[model samples]
Target chain A: MNTTTKAEKTEKFAEHLDQANIQGRGVSPLTKLDPNLTVREAYQVQLLTIQKQLEAGQKIVGKKIGLTSVAMQNLLGVDQPDYGHLLNGMVIENGEEISFHKVLQPKVEAEIAFVLKKDLAGPRVTEMDVLQATDYVLPALEIVDSRIADWNIKLQDTIADNASSGLYVLGGKPLSIDKLDLAQVGMVLYKNGEIMNTGVGAAALGHPATCVAWLANKLFEYGITLKAGEVILSGALSAAISGEPGDHFQARFAHLGEVNVRFSNKVDQ
Target chain B: MSTVNYQSTAEFLHRAETEKKDVFRITADYPDMTIDDAYKIQEKLVAIKLGQGHRVIGPKMGLTSQAKMKQMNVEEPIYGYIFDYMVVPEGGALSMQELIHPKVEAEIAFVLGKDIEGPGMTGAQVLAATEYVVPALEIIDSRYENFKFTLPDVIADNASSSRVVIGNRVTDPAGLELDLVGVTLSINGEIKDFGAGAAVVGHPANSIAMLANMLARKGEKLKAGDVILSGAVTGAVMLSVGDTVSAKLDGLGEVSFKVIE
Candidate 1:
């Protein structure tokens, strides 16, 4: 139902996001620009921006799946989940202080990080394949930032904006996937020493590996393959917590150690 | 002047490091040890390493970032000595057998053009004395098991200082925005971490200034040509044999090395 051509919308959204990144200013949601944009068109828009980053010398490290939980899906008014490209520039180490100026409307969430030892490709990738390919599983913190102004985003808007992915932190000790049952693992998130939220691995699409399998099979439609030695961040285990400067956030996973991140007051120019 | 046995403690740490063995935290034996006593032990340890024909190449600042300070529940930065034996040349190989529980951190190394001695050195003064800045990767191997230690325990263990790899590209500090410089650390050709120079106490040069002041309290000084590692920009990444780690600094070049068994 959109009046504009797909190419035109892709170019427009790409330029808008590029400018937003460069100027440290968030723009209106993509859905606002074209209310009739289809999910397929939205993914094209996402690809356009990712292509621009690739051209700028940033490499693709892995991918992230979003809105995997029923709560998140309901919040976005979407029936299914979406995937996004994770670039090399989006990774932060555990206990690192992130600058406040680099992101717009940032939030933090606890998740599981899967480090793959074997390549997985296909329309038929299964949870078993994900388990077989996984080299280790570790605790991670995903700092989600919306390029859409004030986080005013719709399903298509976020899908077009790389599923609101920003940065991630992998820390604590990694363990072989065969050691423990991941679905029952409990997560407790603390902000400045106070309990902020709590969740379990089941919240991430019943099992974290299932989410990765979903991502692998989803990308196969576009002929993309999940490479070996790549790191994949499973969807958030709980609702996102708002980020603020000078805040200390820590996530503890049962059996898997803990990961922490802090926000600094410094503003990058 | 103090009752604490500094020489034996220093010798113990030196032997433990050279032997690549994990030991009990010093605090377990010396619960009443003061910070001053710990610093004396550190100095004695440095003297022993220097006596063994290893040159004192520079000094390293630790816990300079607010996040690390908060995580460790401490206040200010700490300083440690780096020896010539700890310098792993760019693109060199680090042996896992030589270290116990080693982890790598991305940082910025500032080489001074002139001596800086300070009771009150400012960040601007530190920058003025800096000759050039380059990307650096620090390999920290705590002699204590599981890396759990108190301030005295860590200080007496040379602040967990082990190895450092400096980048190839060098840029002058003049007119360069040292605070906003970005860094990306990759393992096996994939980025595993990213941060900015601002993480080092709001600015990299601030760590240098703090180092100058901290040294001055002990009547010491940072000499010209000293390579100062301005603390880690991110948390340490555990290293494994056969893994190649690389750190790329925006505007500065990259530093890389491989771990071998």
Candidate 2:
């Protein structure tokens, strides 16, 4: 019943998303481009986009997990989470300002970021394993952008769009977890000096460490080991808030200090 | 003297809040725990939170009802701090998983236009500093089992501060008789309880003035940007999953939230 197969469409969708990002605008959804793109094939599209980024000399520093909430998981009919590569180019210095037109339709989310000290090889990694491997935790602000027009995206569309990853800013305070309880941590997200949202560490699938464990196990099937010295943004603590040019965001976390980033007041493009 | 020291007790209570698990009352374990020791634990707890960069939004009152105070045999009501994180959106869903046993009640909130400090702060001073008064629906969740705790016990527990939903309507207190401000509490489209501002420390402003005096003992003053909750105006109602709670103030508009499993 199909003419263009999933694999064939995967190659085109990868290029399409790449161009969408490059043009600083969103195109149609990947599902609309393929109409039968499987989650597996969408990941293929994601990897190919990474390949394109690699060819442009961007290094893969880490990976990011998305859709960790049960509500989001059920909506996509997935039990676990989908991931996207975090490129070195995607790491923004805390409190730095980026051009507004650098990415299309950017929404910022506050998260708890982890820096790994040991490699997490998957299939049986536990929450304890994650905490043990973590070198330190910090506050993080992730600017999630979509290449799908109007953010009308399905699971496959976002999966192919690299889980809507745009850029991230990490807090300077790197705190150890020896005396800290990961589930007890709290975060409040602010936009333009007003409180936007608040959440606890348990919001990310009961505990943020659990999210890392799930990520490791999921990546085992793809022959990926979460390498050390990598910056892993576990998941968002609160809902992402939309921003306009010149908007500012500050996320204050319990024991983690604060992290902030702002957008350029004027759009060049 | 209490068996366990203040620091360890504060840490344990903080752990329960993080774990969302209820434990035996601190007083149960330390029967000799005095109101002074309870406040010492509370101070240490607040210090830990502030050291962790948690901003204290304002102070909140408990046992403001004379009847409840008389039952507890306490002359002064217990108080706690509301961290910035305890505030939820004006209209939002509160996940039950984040709390142990949360009860909802209507409150009148004061947003100060000017700072007020004191051992001798009066209700008139509180009213004069008031920028506006707004309605708030406070969801109090005690980490203690059965919500049973002494005055000192609740103070150390931050008055069981869990989540608070603020209303958008900001009415100036100068234009209204605060003592006569009546509130009706509803659950799932049914009225549950009703009371007026008079129920709180004779006048709602006096409750905040009392809170001001309490903070004065600690050498702290209410900040201009601070928000003070004038205790519960109605009897606390138990919330269940799928329950829509609405509180309509006499002159102020309604504030509500839905409890989610």
Candidate 3:
């Protein structure tokens, strides 16, 4: 789809989302009326719609990396997975109250977010490319959800499903990527003030930037470019820790500060 | 400022494996090691073990999912090592405490009759390089207590090396799209999860290519007759003792095991 048409569709779709209050009607399954559109095709169309919306006024904040875990690979039935962009408006700061109603179905993940110092542009992006481009890295939390109910999705289903991504929050200190030993960095996930799980940077393909490289290189095939000042959610330290309303989630980093998320009983308006 | 002599390190690790010394302790400071340096040590250790008698049965793939990356706060997938002796049979029981911090994942194992490596290898190349595919249960257990580890610790530990169980073999991808492969994983007879191979970078074979190119970047190539795990077909499921789990793939086969106290 052309970027221009995509922008228009994105605006229309966003309006539909806003009008539905992003919570009330939920999303209806697309079928029958679009005979030529497969689930995958419909998703691509949706992405264009969403992409256009973001391009209009919203600032693209970061991207979330998925399917980097062996378990998730088996669960999703894919080897390597893709990512979805996170807009500045999407991030819910640590300890900031979030409404369970604001989202459809959300899952929480602990991640290390990176802010690039320079634009990451390349047809052949490498780990070095990411390292050179990265300004700093921080511990963060990724709140993921799918427009597809129950996350019953195909590869294209998710791609068009906005990469099955949602909101995120950055925590702790943002350290230079070069100075930090990313592979050795550690993190702990706590729910409602209890330590639920712990992991390290090694969990990310040995290095978090490697995930960035994968994302950049992979997205190149899609003709997407990761710009400077853009943030990237590298990957998770461990598996996901599910949460609900009033449940508080915290991530403590070894060298970075802790990030917290508190879910509110209220739903998104 | 003394640097490690990799050859000696390899020999030392090999000796420990042959002696079956479970207490062969490595300093916890290994996380700061670079990938090149870590591989040097690993090659030596692996070579020592291979020379002494233990067989290198297969290689395990890690972090193949996006959700998993976020959960662990990681950005990329890591890797591990597997030994023939590490194979846990179908329906076998294992102790939860046996591992430092462990997780279970269902996967499709690609047993190679020929070696494969590539910076330019494609999915088709992997298929051409592969001999057979099998259902597998990979138990990812880190040696680091509480799972506090660095990249070096993991690679040295064989990427959270644990036991793996290979199910009945399926000889061909001829009828399988590799991407369309599906799996239903159940715990204690309860259907807990379901996923497909297409989720693995569009195809299970793509995972092998990822690994191959990754290895090639290190000047290493997957040797012939080496079993290379393509990657996880299903996202990992957390484990608990007394949990009996079974994963059935659409066309590949099924693998099952029990978790014990």
Q: What lDDT does the true structure give each of the candidates?
A: 0.85, 0.84, 0.69
Q: Which stretches of candidate 2 lie over 4 Å from their true place?
A: A1-6, A74-78, B1-261
Tell me, by lDDT, which candidate is best.
1
lDDT of 1 by residue, A1-269 (tens): 36566577689887887677877888887777778888888899899889988998999998888998878888888777899989999989889989888677789998888989999998889999999999999999999988888989898888889989999999889799775666546566778986555555666776788899999998988889999988899888777999888888998776678899999976564
lDDT of 3 by residue, B35-121 (tens): 667667777767766776889876666766555556656655666568887788877876666554456777778877678877897
Which candidate do you rate higher for TM-score, 2 or 3? Answer: 2
* Whole-model alpha-carbon lDDT for candidate 2: 0.84
As for candidate 2, its clashing pairs are none
Q: Candidate 1: where is the Cα deviation over 4 Å?
A: A1-269, B1-3
Residue B90's lDDT in candidate 2: 78
Superposed Cα deviation of residue A258, candidate 2 (Å): 0.7
Ranking by DockQ: 2, 3, 1
Clashes of each: 0, 0, 64
DockQ metric for all predictions: 0.01, 0.03, 0.02
